[model samples]
Every structure is written in structure tokens, then in C-alpha cells.
Target: MIGFSCYLSEPADEQQTAYLKQMQQAGFTGVFTSLQLPEDDPKTLRQRLNHLITSCHQLGLAVVADISLASLKRLGIAPRDCSGIEALQLDGVRIDDGIDMTTVAALSHTMGVALNASTLSAETIDQLANAKANLRHIEAWHNFYPRPETGLDPCWFQQKNHWLHTLGFKTMAFIPGDAQQRGPLFAGLPTLEPHRGLLPLAAYLDLKRLATDHVYIGDPQLSPRSIAAFQAYTSDQVLLIQTQTADDRLYHLTWHNRPDVAQQVVRLAEARLEHIFAAPEPHHTDERPRGSITLDNTRYGRYAGELQITRCDLPADPKVNVIGHVAPVALPLLDHVGPHQALRFKQ
Candidate 1:
């Protein structure tokens, strides 16, 4: 299930409601929100949460609140208590911090529990297993780092996700949003820390190949263009490409490369498509990186029509036109495309 984050600091205005509706239209099924109760006026906080929760429910979207022990303590709430869950119309809670297996197990009975995906260790999993935690109501999710260069490593992310699966928990991770970013650099927080520079749609599609059950945009909001790209990707309407200087030749030529699922690289026969946009053949073919598409010069000459997507970084060749690379974070999705999958470009 794809989800998005909405900070409590943001207001619940009609614009926000419209954003949520747009997300729903774009194939998002869930949202993550944070809650903090005030000592002076609990009513105000309640009203805020109530409004947001009601709005999400109206759009058929589920809401999960981010909570920590400190927040619970501030609210004077019990670790396993869920007294106002129904009233608030919350679907679940993401226990961001202060994890105790026994308490987590107890909390599972009353409400759905989402553990920190990035922090769950083998020892913790064993403890939870020994405590007989309700795995059904429990899930794992990685937190987004608000600061730059603080996101988790992709290698470790895959390892952790695989580990969580063995323990019967589906894992969720986040990718930064490129549009309407909400942070220091105007790039949303992403679980794969390195993905802060990637296009939001490309990042989302890339993470899908890593077996992440849920992928969310870590920003408070996304732009309309980003929203539309996500919607198109979900519907298998396009392959979002982030082109570089080397890829200018292919980037300007907009012929769809139909995915050949069996081969992992979609083949675009330049000979078949009349509109090559008069792209010049590569004077020099460079090293082809995975997600890099190479224009085949020998197969069809200067009008080199054949394009191949590299599964991994390949040696640079003078014969083929190595135009651009598929953004690194989005590379994992190359293999999952159905045969004849459509493609799209974003420069």
C-alpha cells in the first residue's frame, strides 16, 4: 500500500483536503500523521486530530499516527491504551520510539502496531517472537530522515527488509518528494538517504523492486506534476526517466520503448518508428550504466534505432550510443516492467 506523511504542524485546510483527494486518485491508500497533545488544552489537539482523521476517512484513506514514549507520557496515556482510537478514527499507530516487546505485544491486541523498520534487530525480533506478539496486527516501517545525508543505506535497507519478511512482517520505506518539497533543501526526507536527490516518481518506482510493501512520500505535500507522474506509474502508463547530459540525444527523441519483461531491457527499434526526431548518432558511445540506454549504431546505422537498457554497469563502447542513465534509486524497477511496458521522460 502506497502512503504519504502529513505533519501535525500543517493546517487542515481545504487545500490540504484537496491534496489528500489527489493522492487518493494517484493510488495512495494510506497516510502517516504525527500527534502531540498539549497540557493546557487537550481539546484543541483533539479537534485538530479529529478534523484530519475525519477528512482522511472521507477519502477512503487510512490514517496512522506517529507516536513516541515521550509523546505518550506527555499525553498521560498508557502504552497499550487505545481509549480514543475509535473516536479519532485512526487505523493504526506507528510507534516511532520506545519499543518494548511485551508492551508492543499488548498494544497489538487493541490496535495495529507499526514498528521501526530501520531499528528492528534480530534480537528484537526474537524477543517479539518469544513474547508471541500478534504478527498480524504488526508491521515494520522505516522513518524518514529530515536532515540531509542521514538516510539509511540501500544495501542495509534490502537486508533489513529481507530479515523482516522472514519474521512475518511486511516492511515499508520512504522516498523523498521532488515536487513541493518540505525541508532544508526543498527535497523530502527519504528512507534511502541517498535518494534525496532523485525524482519522487523515479524513487518510488525504484523502491518497489526492493520488496518494500509500502512506499510513502516523506514530504508534507507533492506538486501536481509529481502527483500525475506517480499516478501514471501506478497504472503502468509510463517509465519515468531522469536524463543527463550524455542522454540528450535519446531524451529529445520521444519514441516509447516497449518493455521486454523477459530480457529486463526494453527494446526500442528505431527502424520501426519513423519519428526519430532527427537525433544525431553518438559521435562517441560511452560506458553504459545500469538504467543507461544505449543506441545501437551498427544495427541500423547513424539513425541508430535500437536502444537497450543495461541491467548493470557495462563497459563503454564506441559502437553504441550511451545516452543517459535511469536515476540510481529508480534502477531496481527496470526488471519488473511487463513486456512492452511504456516509457516517459523527465529532464
Candidate 2:
């Protein structure tokens, strides 16, 4: 199924409901929302999110929400303080920190929502296993860790493949490669229909070679070229091409002045593809890094301060301490001590 991230930005509940319904009709299987709670007042946040969850459930759509330690810290509470409320909202908790397992597990128990860890790591997997929590899935880019040999390590590919099979976890990998790279990646993993941003015509055609079960065109503003390309390639082969409204300030400045162009693009693309979904806005954090390095560093630190070093000072003793007993300085011993030997004896 395809889905879009939903941001409850509208002031009125009626508008929010209408917007969600529109998204549901647009072919989104799920919606991701951001519910911020006060650290000292998680109960209030829980109440708000509960309402949103109930609303989505009524629409017969799955809902996912973000729960971050930093967001809690802003409310002046720690993860422990929000455990009870988290358990109450537990459809999914965005795993931003390594220490959120306890709260996530508690929330999962109460709300029956599986945890979806974003930007996951080996350590996070171990933590989830230790907590005995069922992790829903991981959201990552396919070219996260670049390999020197193949540009992406086949070994890492094998590891993730094995891990997914053993752990029964789903992976969502986004790719923005040209047609050449996209074809092989998609053909290699038929089950993984990656979410991709805009690409050139050549690359888009390459994507057509493989059965593109799902496609996400991030640009809201419709371009003549993009619309034409969508119409040309997305016939019967592609499943869905989800697009968002281009109402942001940046989208207007960069793409075009028309804010509604995004919707127009999606509409046109859908007309061509037949299977298209639309959302009022994009759910992803605007703070997305340009590259994998930024994403990795944001999730993990170098641990420079945690590293330790050891050093030793050598003595300037002239006498040879070769024997067990300390001997008086002797001319013969000094003659035997060459420059190299003397340097070694200094230790």
C-alpha cells in the first residue's frame, strides 16, 4: 500500500477531517502525523493524538505519529515521565534516540501500535530485541552507506536481506538515482518499491522497465515536462504516483510561483497513471539532510569524547639496567651503548 505523511496544520477539526478523507480517497493506505506534547503535560498531547487516531480509524486508514525525546524535553519531561501516555498512543513511535525503547515498548503494550524506527542502526535493533518489542519497520535510503567497490556494498545488502528475513521486518528505502541505477535496484528486489523524488526522463523510462508497483513524485508543482513524462511512462505498469500540495514558501520560489501547481501536477500525473494519491502537504521533516552523511551524523555521533588514549614517558638513565642489579656507570658499558642502543635503553 502507498501512504503520505499528514500534518494536522488546520485549526479546525472539520478541515482536518476533510483533508484526511481527501488523502484516503487519493490512495494513501496510511498517514503520519506529528503530535507535540508538553514534557510536563503528556496527558494533553495523548488526548489530542488519541482523537486523531480515532478519526483515522473511522476513515479505515492506518495512522502513524512521531514521538521524539527532544520533543518531550521541550515539554520539560524525560522519556520515563511519558511512558504511560506513550503506551496510550502506541501505534508507532518515531525512534529518534536510542533510549526510547522503554517508552516505546510501554506505548506498544498500551496502544497496540508497532514501533517504526527511522534511521535505524545495528545497536537499535539489538535494543528492540532486548526489549522484546515488535518493530514495525525502518525508513531509510537505499544508498545510505556508500561502498568503495560497488558504490554500495553487496555485503551490507546481504546483511539487511538476512536481517529482514530473520527479524520479520519491513524496509522502506528511498532512491533518487537515474534510470540506469534504478532499474537494477528495483529488479534485484521486486518486493522493495522505493519511494523516489523527481528524476530525468531517461531515468524515469528506465524505471518503467521494471514493474514499478509504487512511485512517489515529491514535487507538488506540475511541470509540462514532468506531467508529460508521467503520462508517457505510468500506463498500466506503475501502481501509484503519490504527490503533495506545493504550498510551502520554498516550493513557490524554486519550482514556480503557482502553489496549486503541485496539485495540478498530481492530477495530471494521476490522469496518466490512473493510480495516484494526493495529500494536503508532505509529512517528512523539512530538516531532511541533502545526503546520507548528514542523516547518519544526525542519528549517530562520532563519540570523540568517549575515546581513550594512553602514553608513557621514558627515563633518561645513562647506566645500562640490563642485569637485575643496578651497576655504577662504567666506560665499557657506555662504549657498548651506541646511539641506537642508548635510545632503546632510555626506556
**Which candidate has the top score in lDDT?**
1
State, as a TM-score between 0 and 1, how close model 2 is to the true structure.
0.41
Residue-wise lDDT of candidate 1 within 136-202, one digit each (tens)? 9999999888787788888888888888898889888888776566745665688897678776776
Candidate 1 versus the native: TM-score? 0.76
lDDT of 2 by residue, 1-347 (tens): 34344443323377567755765654445555555433334455555667777878888877655556666565455667756445444355444443466665555444534333224567766876688754544332232212212333334544554455465554333223222222213322111222232243232333233322223221112233334333433332221111222323212211111123221111111111321122112122232111100001111233111100001112322211111111121111221111211100110
lDDT of 1 at 238: 74
Q: How much does each candidate deviate from the true structure in C-alpha RMSD? A: 5.0, 28.0
Runs of candidate 1 with Cα error greater than 4 angstroms are: 36-42, 85-87, 129-132, 183-187, 241-266, 269-339, 345-347
For model 2, the run of ten residues with the poorest summed lDDT: 289-298
How does each model score on lDDT? 0.72, 0.36
